[model samples]
Target: DSFNAFMSLNERAARSALLDIQKALGPFRNERVLAATAVTDMAISSLQRRSVTIYLAPNITDMTVLRPLLTLFVQQVMDLLTREHNPDALPVYFLLDEFRQLKKMDEILNKLPYVAGYNIKMAFVVQDLKCIDEIYGETARHSLLGNCGLQLILGANDQVTAEYASRALGKRTIRYQSETRTLELFGRARRTRVEQIRERDLMMPQEVRQMREDKAILLVEGQRPILASKLRYHAIEPFKTAALASRQNTVPVPDVEMARALPVPATLPDYAVDGPDPRPGRIELDRHEVIDDAAFEASSAENVDAAVSSKERLVVTARKLKSVIAACLSAADMPMNQRISIQDVLAKTIPDPEEVGLD
Candidate 1:
């Protein structure tokens, strides 16, 4: 009784929150979110695993749906790492590109430290540090930077990132030498020795800001900052070949003629029973008659020609309908045997033209 009471409260809270968000979804019209919330008890590890790619196209403007999807994925991956009882699970690589797009990223950043133990690793790709700091706040920003084992900082134009990089490198001591020789009118020259010397940042903020595009700073724990040249992937031997291989040509336009030529599958009883069954073929019409549906029963010769043309069109339409129904049945989630039975019943239920001719 107590457990059920707590569960009811939990359900109420969840429903209120989830429904509010679901109401704003324009793409999921005519569908209730409750059906999506239904859960089945099963072992997650039993499912055949494959690489999961969550590509958020730039065109997607709705963060409400996209953020939840991304959060769910990240949470599941992190959960896998937490399963100490199931250590045999396959390792997962959670790569988040353009990380700023997702909201409430601090939760994920906090889990980064513990992920490695569960065979899960995450790579968060951001354009700049400021982008994340603004979203996750300064505390989360620091935690993220501190937890990462290695950092490759490319040339940064932003003052905040450049200054952060300078501070991150720590201080270095270098010899200072200066000679100030000034000869005033009828005065002797004065020289100053290299007496003023102190520790200074290894790389100044301005220097880091003006760094060459090809140059990057490689920072590793317990190791001196190394200035390295960025790899030119397009020009590299193996990478260049791979890059060219991955390139795709622009998609061609659809063929309207080919689409129009596609025939629909359906059946008509009139064509099956009648002697003349002209369907999906050339309809021989009398030049004197205009093939009018209203004059199908006319006793004149023109009426007879119109009736034949009308019958031919009806048979073609029936065939098209049959094809559509078959496709619909196949697409349904019902069992194969059940679907076949339903389709058979549908075929038989179509009234015979001889028994009930079109009025």
Candidate 2:
């Protein structure tokens, strides 16, 4: 039974490799489960039988593609794990590196509690908290990171992320103050000592300097970096070597277009132009068509009288039909078609109606 399934044509080979590892492990014992990361091409169904699967999808700049794929992958993994139970099975450690490359990973992380019952542990490696916050927002970052048992942060350049990391690691405060002491002579010959209040703490200058220079910091179980190492001196060398090697002999391949041509229709149809002209010629109004002061005055007087008479009639009509409008709106027994007709009637009642133009 395969533990991990990858769902891509490009990742079929990698998926096979993961299945090989599962087969070699032979029923899951306490073995260091290290396999090359699975790409997105591998489908979830391929690894349905496997106890654990780690997906290593590429960093996609487009959220449209990345989000749905990751969401589907996480949901499928959770569903598969939840469906099966093996009390004697070995715990699955799911490692997701460059996790921020996936869109909305925080949503997937939020639901990880469901798989906790199946003894599935998840480790997400991201460049910084800012990356997570950018993809998942601040609220999600808090919830996702809070859920994790251990958080390992490497070199972080941003102050906001550093402050978050610092808070997570916890802090200790030390206070110091300077004061002047003086002796006061109250009476002619009596002198008493007068002392000013001061506070201080013991903090080594070298320790502060080291903290500033340290690039790597590990926070485990909400504990400070009791065992932190500088990446330059203590970290593994193979990773840097592999990254450099992978960059070499990487020549860009030119895109090749397929030779096949698409089929075309034999006959095309034409239609008459309608509505407003896209490019209308400018025209000047004739002198007779233009309005003069006498014509304007006569038109204004006629329009005003007609409008006043029409408004009075409209008010009376509105008063009479107010009950009908109210009845239509409140008609619970009205069918959908009738309600639509009533809505159309009300919509058509707007003043200065425009043509229902089509593109």
Candidate 3:
């Protein structure tokens, strides 16, 4: 009786389905298809669990191929944070170097303000405020900047960054006095003194731009901002030696707790399998989906047989499929699965037991 349900797949319907698939897959029929699927180690769960995970772009020259891949990986990382987090877990700090270069993470960054509660921390290393404004626009840029508990500005060579840094550090009120001495012909007939209070930026925009390499601004929540000395790590003890070693090695992991330097592979390893699940009660996530009638019709576009009512269409198509059923029966000697493919284009359905002579 299951065969009776899918009794509407006529030649026109089949052609429509084929055309839809062609349209969807048309743009993907290129050499780049391999590059899209080449990345196999997209397992975000285990990678998120590690003390440190790095996504090294294979070729920066091919940004067309690379940025989208980076965007996909970043999305997976964001998704992992949503579903997987322990209450007692330490903050998983994601330090995005060259934050402006990555695209399509605007939506992800929009939610970063609230995700800090999930033990997720984001350190965006941006060159200037203009880049953030250009990439993410004003609203998302505000959200990203508002979420920062600590803002460390090393150098502000650009006016945009310098201005933003100046504003963020805030203003201070200063009191000063001015005395006016009278000349006989002047408007002031007598000496008078006046005191005035004016607000000035804690650090002016020009001052920020002119800040030396050794100097930096540190802005902390609920505290006065500081113009502090940037740590001269090259002059520091262990860091000095580590910096020397980094010139010879690729990854210069500093001497710290759980700082193990592992060799980055040319291609990330893929531990995924295509076979059926071995677990008894595992949910089948990759099975064929049942498309509803309305959805199928919408995707197929305006039907060729608009005059045929759906019920009549099913009856007519079933009558037309008699030849297909006969062809399937001719292959009855073959395995059931082999015989089943004889006329699959007609419909995805089962043959009645009486029609197949099974009973």
Number of the top-ranking candidate, with TM-score as the measure: 1
Q: Give the Å shift of residue 162 in candidate 3.
A: 1.9
lDDT of 3 by residue, 1-359 (tens): 53453356787876777697676455355445444565555455554456656655555666654665576667777777768557765467778888777864865776676777787877888888778889778777777788888999999889888999989988999998999977676564778899999999988999999889898899898898988997777898799999988877887569763323444442223312444322322222334676676766564443433323444655655776776667666867987566555357445344454444345
**Model 2 lDDT on a 0 to 1 scale:** 0.57
- Which candidate model has the greater TM-score, 2 or 3? 3
lDDT scores of the candidates, listed in order: 0.68, 0.57, 0.70
For every model shown, the clashing-pair count is 3, 11, 0
Expressed as tens digits, the lDDT of each residue in 1-359 for candidate 1 is 85465456676786775676675454345233233334534444443254444444534665555566556656765665475644665666666777777666555776788877766667787778899778888888888988888888977879889999999988988777877777867797777666566899989999899898889999998898899988898998898888887775546778553222323232333444555544333344554868765454344555456667777767876786687677776768977665556656656546455533465
List, residue by residue over 1-359, the lDDT tens digit for candidate 2.
23334433247787777787676454223221111122234555434345545644544553443454455557667676566766654666667776765556444665676667767677888877788888878887888877887766555566666667655555455444555555457634433454555432222222322454555556677454543666652245877777677679588989864233433432212111333322222222344687667776676676666556666766765665676667666985888665657555565443222221111
Scanning candidate 1 in windows of ten residues, the lowest lDDT window is 257-266
List of clashing residue pairs for candidate 1: 265-319, 265-323, 266-319
**Highest lDDT: which candidate?**
3
Comparing 1 and 3 by lDDT, which wins?
A: 3
In what order do the candidates fall by TM-score, top score first? 1, 3, 2
Number of residue pairs clashing in candidate 2, backbone atoms closer than 3 angstroms, sequence gap of 3 or more or interchain = 11
